[model samples]
Target: MRFNTAPAPHLAPTASTRRIMQWVLVAMAPGIAAQLWQFGPGVLINLALAIATALLTESAMLRLRAQPSRAGLSDWSAVLTAALLAVSLPPIAPWWISVFGALFAIVIGKQLYGGLGYNPFNPAMVGYAVLLISFPKPMTAWLPPTDLAATPLGLLDAWSAIAHRAGPAGSSFDALAMATPLDTLKTQLGLGRTMDEVQSGPLFGALAGKGWQWVNLGYLAGGLWLLRRGLIAWQIPAGFLAALGGLSLGFYLLEPQTYPTPLFHLFAGATMLGAFFIATDPVTASTTPKGRLIYGALIGGLVFVIRSWGGYPDGVAFAVLLLNLAAPTIDHYTRPRVYGHPG
Candidate 1:
């Protein structure tokens, strides 16, 4: 009898990294659209710059390593990293910011260690952390939501603001930039103000903040889609949200005048985005089911700690990077035993 078996991998692959990356980009659409509606074209402008720079840097790195550029580029990991880093930046950040960030993300964060899955840290988060540490002022120059902006710029004017060019009718870039809702709350809390007093501002919308709730919801919706499609593990997001919300509820209940509501914490900053998209990154996250829950919970706890007391208003990036360092250890301890093996 003739055997029909080839080499290994007799079953065809159900998914590719490229395909997964494409789905991630698609999942980001709603959140991106919300940002555009709230802050205008700054995100798009930065995204274009970051993508171009990431591709160039990736190509150069691939050539240096004597690898096929098309295979690397077609994988879409570079694009996703670029998009994530670009989106995380302040909308009015200068063009050089995105360019520099993309360079760092692809070259140092990813390729320096061999590229893609080889890198231990999330490339986008690395770029973001570096930018945050290096350029604190520019990194925090977020524009207020359109309704709250005193002089909201049009698409051309937004580009001009990013370009450091004078806006139409002498509108200034500084006029548009302000603290994010999270920053505002943090500052007010530092100043010993009650939640009720802080919530009176236009910055605080019905749920979280002006435009922020919708952005978080959009991401949550996209995240749900990915879950349904089986592209990501539910344990990570579930554990993250549960811990964050649970902690927030505890603090808020203890001092209603001090801490904000659980919904505010859930819908604020990068909570949903980090929980759904960033924390669930398969490479930096744990492999085992139980390990993932512990990993995500630790991240969530660190986020709460940082936001409550640390310097940064949002701690998602830092939390994720810190947790990335522990993923291997978590997997080691949580590894399942063989069915027939004795302890």
Candidate 2:
């Protein structure tokens, strides 16, 4: 009998990167649908444009780098990054904004750093931050929640708005644009208004902003679904929310006039999204369970600090990016000890 041996051993079948990314995309669907329903058709248009631009840019870069385009595209990582970026951006922002952001994410943020696994930052957040800083006006121009709009944009109107800066329904894009709840709170706080006064405004939907609360709830539902599917673990989200809520509660209890309620901090802006999705990016976040908790706590703390003191109305992107920078150090320090090794 002759024994044949190969240089490398074959492994059993398991989940592929593409399958993981696909699940992530699926988990985002509820939030995306809710955004479309609440904010009109601009979100859908942005999603389409961003996806196209990301795929195009990814393909072009792969070809230039002498890598197989089909394999790279099949991973769905680029599409997930594009979708995340698109959802975070202002729904009514011009077509060029999404195009530029997606291209920058795929090329500069992801590829220039040697593609997905090598990138230090979350590609989607990098794109969002770039657009937010470069085009302040458009980036902050969130549409009034569907209920508040005088004339909600239809699909054709949304297309026209992106294409021409005016809707087919004869409304200027500016007319449809409105400040988000976090923006309103930040501006009001800057003006020296108390939380009570700001809460009296129509924008305050129940505990959070009006239409925005439902959007947050939708995202929360999706996040929980992801948790149930085992696509994500509970440690990150639990730690993030616990830290954020703990801090917010402490502050609000100390000074009710100045600080908003803990519920507001949890429901407003991208708190839920950041906690579940953004901060949990496998490539950019800590790997150890203990490290993940620490990482998430840091993000939550930073978010509170930035929202309360920093110039930006919402701090999810900044918080996530800052935490991403610290993830490696966190992993290094928090790695589990070997079972048979001495301390």
Candidate 3:
């Protein structure tokens, strides 16, 4: 018998890092568009400044680490990180604020931990948390939706607001700022207001905030698309939303006057964003099939607990970061048994 010789074995990954990052960026377009439609031109300004800062910082870090800058930059992890952090921020924040956050995200949150997959926590959330802690005032200085604002800011006005060197009509930054719906709700609840009284303002619409609910819907559309494309597993998102919704529903049913509607909790603030995008981060989330569910549920539960009782108005970033710290432990215990391993 004649033996046929074959070439040496080769390795090829089905989806490269660049491709994966591209998908993620594409998935964000709808959410970003929804935000722009509702908020105004400020989001665009924030995104531009943030992407620029992220790329610059990523390049610098790669150089310092003696890594190939081109390869690192091409993967677009920096871009995604910057975008997530940007969206989480108040759109009217100064350009320098975004620059600082992007720099911190790329450097301390990523490179300092050996970059990308090696980082135990989410880089974007780290930057966001740091900014929230350091610059509490500006971080919470959100603007009302364009339709709600008495004077909807034009592109130039947005530019002036973000630059902080000039004002559209000699008005201070605070003049254009308004509290977010979540912030308003928390303040009202603290003042001993009923849920009905708290959500009576124009800021509160059908479900969540006036313009914010649509943004969450847009993100949901994108997330469903990502799921259909098999880019992300459904277990995590399902577990997260289910846990949050279940818990919120229980409370709302018990004391509707004290608690906001369950829909409000589901569609408000960053709940959808965290469930679909942030908490689902593969590098920082649990890997095992069972572990993913537990991991996601833990994040959801923490979000509820913190939002109801903690200092922050929204808890998605904090919840995700906290769970990222426990992901390894979750995966270890929940790992699937080997095909031939004994029970």
Per-residue lDDT tens digits for candidate 1, residues 279-334, read 99888899899999999999998999899899999999999999999999999999
Per-residue lDDT, model 3, residue 50, is 89
- Candidate 2, residue 106: the lDDT equals 91
* Residue pairs with clashing backbones, model 2: 205-209, 205-210
Give the local distance difference test score of model 2: 0.89
Clashing residue pairs in candidate 1 are: none
Q: lDDT score of model 1?
A: 0.91
TM-score order, best first, reads 1, 3, 2
What are the lDDT scores of the predictions, listed in order? 0.91, 0.89, 0.89
Number of backbone collisions per candidate: 0, 2, 0
Relative to the unseen true structure, what is the C-alpha lDDT of residue 62 in candidate 2, on a scale of 0 to 100?
Answer: 95
Best by TM-score: 1
Give the higher-lDDT candidate: 1 or 3: 1
User: Which run of 10 residues does model 2 get worst, by summed lDDT?
Assistant: 5-14
Give one digit per residue, the lDDT tens place, for model 2 in 262-313: 9999998998888888888999989999999999999999999999999888
